[model samples]
Target: MSLIPSESMRPHQENVIGSTQLQFDQGSQPRLRVVTHTAKSILVRFGIVGLARQWPSSQRQATILRYHSVSSAGDYRSPTISVHPEMFRRQMEFLSRHYDVLTLDELVSGLETGSLPPKAVAITFDDGYKDNATEALPILARYNLPATFFVTSDAVLGKSAFWTGWLHRAVSSASEETLRKASDSLIGGMSSVLSREKIYAALASQVDHAHGSKRQQRFLALSRAFHHMPPLSSPSDFMMDIDDLRALLSAGMTIGAHTATHKVLAGLPEDDAREELSRSKQELEQALVTPIVHFAYPNGHVASNVDDAAIRLTREAGYRSGGTSRRGAALVGTPTHNLPRQGINDALGFSGFVFKLEEARFSLLLRGS
Candidate 1:
């Protein structure tokens, strides 16, 4: 799914499903939140639920919530990934009140020893967006909860929008007809429908499988093949700048490497993958003035995302743990490198979103947990 909008946005933007409320926090920053919105109401009015309401024991399980952007403007590709600040605050408040909001370091300890606080959960933000530094940080501070930021070194340095961001913008701007034709012409044969979103997804899937110049070459081809065509037009400082990142650490957030560039790892050759992983870890450590010990796979998963080779590289890179987008909580005996996480959409509203989160946590549909 698409996330942040410009090389500037994930690259996920979402529509406000119902009403919108804007409130200023202590810093006088305006945040968009849903206060008893439609999405929340229906989920409650209908009583549509099959999951347990009581908090599940986290004694042997740790939940890692993966978030991309918390902005007023969510990523157009996947709005769910980009949550508005007000909505984000509400969720943070709920988590603080209801669950044991532990830090990434604490979760790591739990993973090693197989013991955690009841209802333990850790929050994480990926891609190092400016909003994460500005908007999300304040709320995190308010709740005094700890989060780990898996930053793409390039984005953190404010170089340009990551390839994922560019891909989303180009595809989203294309006309339906253009999108269809583009999908048909996809370099790697696609097995999904010829929709624009599917086309972007299919191409993104292949990026991890590509190595060296082949990934860049195909990316450029797609950029040209798309409607507007070529070059990452996203403005500089679209992602978090170096100062913003340092400030985040100063405020107590842990930093981890997402990669030098936010590209899939499995597709890259062994040497290239190692460089992306180790280089990023080294760069982050040097820049942030801290030992970077964690790694989150770019497009982390078991499917078209991270693989055993990628995991091996992360281990070689000297990371303490790795996180994946796979649904479920990290339980005892779970591989530390292949830890599972639940991706939440704040647009789902408080009650609705919470139910879905708990459902994913306890349901067998996503995993045996």
Candidate 2:
């Protein structure tokens, strides 16, 4: 028998006051009843009953999973952003077994038309890392799964930045003591009890300094002063090159713009934001010869410095969709331009990945709650 009415239901009255009563009057067996005199009790019961009626089904909603690097060794360091190559393969195997792996275009179209299939997922890689081509592509190809990449155009052509190369090196080389000292130097009067996690978070925040341009420079200066390190000859030391990008595109994978310089768009003036968005899209389109319709914010958090004006500008520039670092399922009817994606890092194994996907699906069913 149907548990809840098929149509969306609303309460008979708004601002319901006084002692409210609920009686499950329609049933073949003994019905349940609850009585509440307090408003909080009534509201709580109403929510519980409503949620009980709209519980998530075994059938899943469409989801898009995001990844950064795919490497076995380095992945362990950043468990939230990188996955080991073998683990990635296991994830693919699991998805193949249970879900229909859709391409980015297919997912976008499904979202537009409200015809997305159950248990559907799309895979995406961010930052255009070289390991993605060397490690991730082969695994995806073996599984016959199509994936999308959001590329930073400058990095593709070989530009070194302080953040990508220096910050990484700093964290990797610094003794725990050095990290604490560096943190104090950068953020003045910061706590000495900073853990490695807090240190990394502070470094990441600097990625938006100078509206994203000086991120590399800041890292280089800090690394040189603190660790006595020499500057890298090539900024692309930590990123994929143009050839790597082309190879991925040639292998039937998709590429989208991640901005020209990976700047946090919200911090810039409108003109600067427009330039960054438009230029990155133009550069990528010129390189790949494909319509660049997707964009990913450099840092997915909502920041006072990031310009929301840029997001609007991206839509105006003809992007069909964009991705955020937010954790949730991409609902079938959600706007393609502001979609949320779950990150697939080392912390998520085969089981954790499944749990996240299920969580996203359940969240979708409980929408408007």
Candidate 3:
């Protein structure tokens, strides 16, 4: 399970109200989602977040936003990994207008010196998506915001396609019946009733834990199974090439290593985990001809995809900092090797973005009440 909260499962209600009032409140949207979005919008509009930031404790904490693809043509297998360009632009504009947007390095430095600014945020992208360069970079440059791109080294080398993209294309292209048949042949028979999301999860879970070479073999086998299916609707270059990395550097963006093959580090042996970290850093450094100082766990859910072993190996492998999918703010005393990050995606619209920036605080108040 991911550390990030599921929007569908989370409920939001404001004030004690009767069924009639609740019906009125719900309007056209789903009751929980409408209430949640409305509640968050109200909080932001009413200066509640601003007032919260006045607290000394709030001032000491900073946010790092994690993103993957930024394009309208998003991944069919995982909508949460993609944010539409327009929404992303609006988010960048909001960050520029309301927060002190800093690079990951700067935010880490502030944490070290205990000098983090109020409302400080850092932007990051994982998986080296081509859309990061094609879509996100222009918007970021428009806002003059700096972000770190953590590229899986194998993807950049073109030795193999990013497994997630390959998986996305294969899974999205096929029908439900086709998927079940393929799953039976490749792994085992999946339940016919399994939804696309569950099927994707089942397949991804398999891919995520495998060794790099084995992972590729599995992905290729899966791809071949779906070969008769029509291609992805929005087929494009999924991963960044070496030149794209150079372009990001020239355009004033930071490059970091996401690991050699983007395997879940916690599942691997210590030596394998260490190799994933060190080798990716070595390869990225060699390719970019610059030091790769930062790292991010592949699945990055603390204690699940990430653990003490993974964190220790990250430090041993010579990373200055490591980002995770653990959902919280990075406080002054937070571990440098296991910094918490909030994942941002399409489902989290502008209102959701506002809420997520201060989600830790909001969740605390909600829980306490």
Per-model TM-score versus the true fold = 0.76, 0.76, 0.83
Model number with the top TM-score? 3
In model 1, the worst 10-residue window by lDDT is 2-11
Better of 1 and 3 by lDDT: 3
Q: lDDT per residue, candidate 1, 1-369, as tens digits?
A: 211112221113222324533233332212234435464565445543223334354366777989988888633334646888898899999888878888888888887887787677889888777788889999999999899999988767655567676676667777776676667677444424455566667777667567778877777677667747446544334478888888888999998889988777886778888888988999878877899998898777565677888888888889989998887678767788888887767656666557545543333211212
Which stretches of candidate 1 lie above 4 Å from their native place?
Answer: 1-57, 74-77, 174-196, 226-230, 233-236, 360-369
* Global lDDT of model 1: 0.70
Clashing residue pairs for model 3: none
User: lDDT of each structure?
Assistant: 0.70, 0.67, 0.77
How would you encode candidate 2's per-residue C-alpha lDDT over 1-369 as one tens digit per residue? 222322233233111224432222222111122224243343334443324223443232477898998887651135457788889889888777767789899998988887777667899988877788999999988888899999888777665442454455556567766766777777663546765556666666765656544755665657654564445444655577878878888888889888887777776777888887899899788876788888887777464433457658779878888887766777667777777787777765454566456554432232322
Task: List residue ranges in candidate 2 displaced over 4 A.
Answer: 1-61, 75-77, 175-181, 189-192, 209-233, 303-308, 363-369
Task: Return the lDDT, model 1, position 212.
Answer: 74
Ranking by lDDT: 3, 1, 2
lDDT tens digits by residue: candidate 3, 1-369: 322234443354343211111111222211222335566667678765455455545567898999998988855327868899999999999889988999888999999999989778999999899889999999999999999999888878776667677677667778767887887887677647676666778888878777758976776677677776333232236788998899899988999889987789887878888888998999889888999999988888646888888889999999999999888788888899999898998887787788778765443332221
